[model samples]
Target: MRLRHKPWADQYMKDNNHILIQEPFEQKGCWKQLFDQQERPLHLEVGTGKGQFIAGMGEQHSEVNFVGIERVKSVIVGALKKVKAKETTNTRLAYVDAEDLRDLFVENEIDHIYLNFSDPWPKNRHEKRRLTYPTFLEQYQHILKDEGEITLKTDNLTFFEYSLVSFSKFGMTLQEVNLDLHETGDETNVPTEYEEKFSQKGQPIYRCRASFSK
Candidate 1:
């Protein structure tokens, strides 16, 4: 998508001086090398809006490799800018649809997956489009390692409730389900751009960490 008028478009275009790839799907293996170079577990964040959370995580946990996936080209470009500005070699951003995750990463490859403030798809007919839908969960199950965990954070209560039910139905174990993460006083839990904006309006953020069952 053209990002000419986006708020961060100009800054992104200027900051993306490091290696930025645009291949469709033929470079997954080469991307894997970038992760392997870190010699640590691989983590992925889907729907990285504005790139705050993943960028912070990448800076905080320099030992772990991070891969962020965004369907919107502009947003992906923005994320790449953050990685470049930080001069982070352990993080990579990919422009791909969430549904095509399995084609991008092999089974037992991913250590963790982050779904940060994903689209709720609130309408009944659009439920299937929700990132936490059963089909997408199954796709995550296929690509993630057997013990891989998914960390989900959202400001939509209905979506959070729906996600709990979906995880149960899929036999994934949910832990640390926080209905109000901000009140918990957990310094380690960094808030993303969307999370911060939504919470400032008195919206509660729902968070949970779930892992695939053996």
Candidate 2:
């Protein structure tokens, strides 16, 4: 669902040049250097809505560089506000299109990718649009390390099953498969807006981490 645009979003994106990256393609293959050349592991969150999960992770893991990518300018503005209000140093927000993701980073430049509550693209015809689809996975592979991890969390059953099969078909080894992440009390989670709301209504949350060997 597309979010309603906030009036101040455009202005906020302009004024917050420190946190919002406008031309991410220019930093392809050199994102680490842009983050002060620290060489810390780069972790990316796709579709970072409201920025709660990445912002929290940024605070908890200061050693890791966190980049949250949201295509919608208005949507990413919320995350920008979260990063600013939290006074976090390790996290940055980027306005990026998922289809062009491969162009924004060179091969083996990303260490991890997080997909939280991503749009299911439920219809059979729209399967190609799913984040875990073979096409998207192929794109991610261009940027991720050999053993780089992709963590996913969602409350949708069909999407969960589809993702599990997709990962297996892509030659990825799945780990920490939890059909009920919230009930299982897996403490290492940073909840997204959708996860928190869905879990509160006795809904089951699914989570897993997949890694590619090749």
Residue 200, candidate 1: how far off, in angstroms?
1.4
lDDT tens digits, residues 80-153, model 2?
98888888778888988857578888999899999999999999999998999998888888889987999999
For model 1, which pairs clash? none
lDDT, model 2: 0.88
lDDT of each structure? 0.80, 0.88
User: In model 1, which runs have C-alpha deviations exceeding 4 angstroms?
Assistant: 1-19
lDDT of 1 by residue, 1-214 (tens): 4565577654565455343545536655445666547568889888876788888898888888888878776677767767777877777776677457877877777889999988889999999989889889988998788878999999999999999999999999997699999988888887898889999999988899999888
- Model 2 lDDT, residue 154, Cα: 93
The alpha-carbon RMSD values of the candidates against the true structure, listed in the order shown, are 2.9, 1.3
- Report model 1's TM-score to 2 decimal places: 0.89
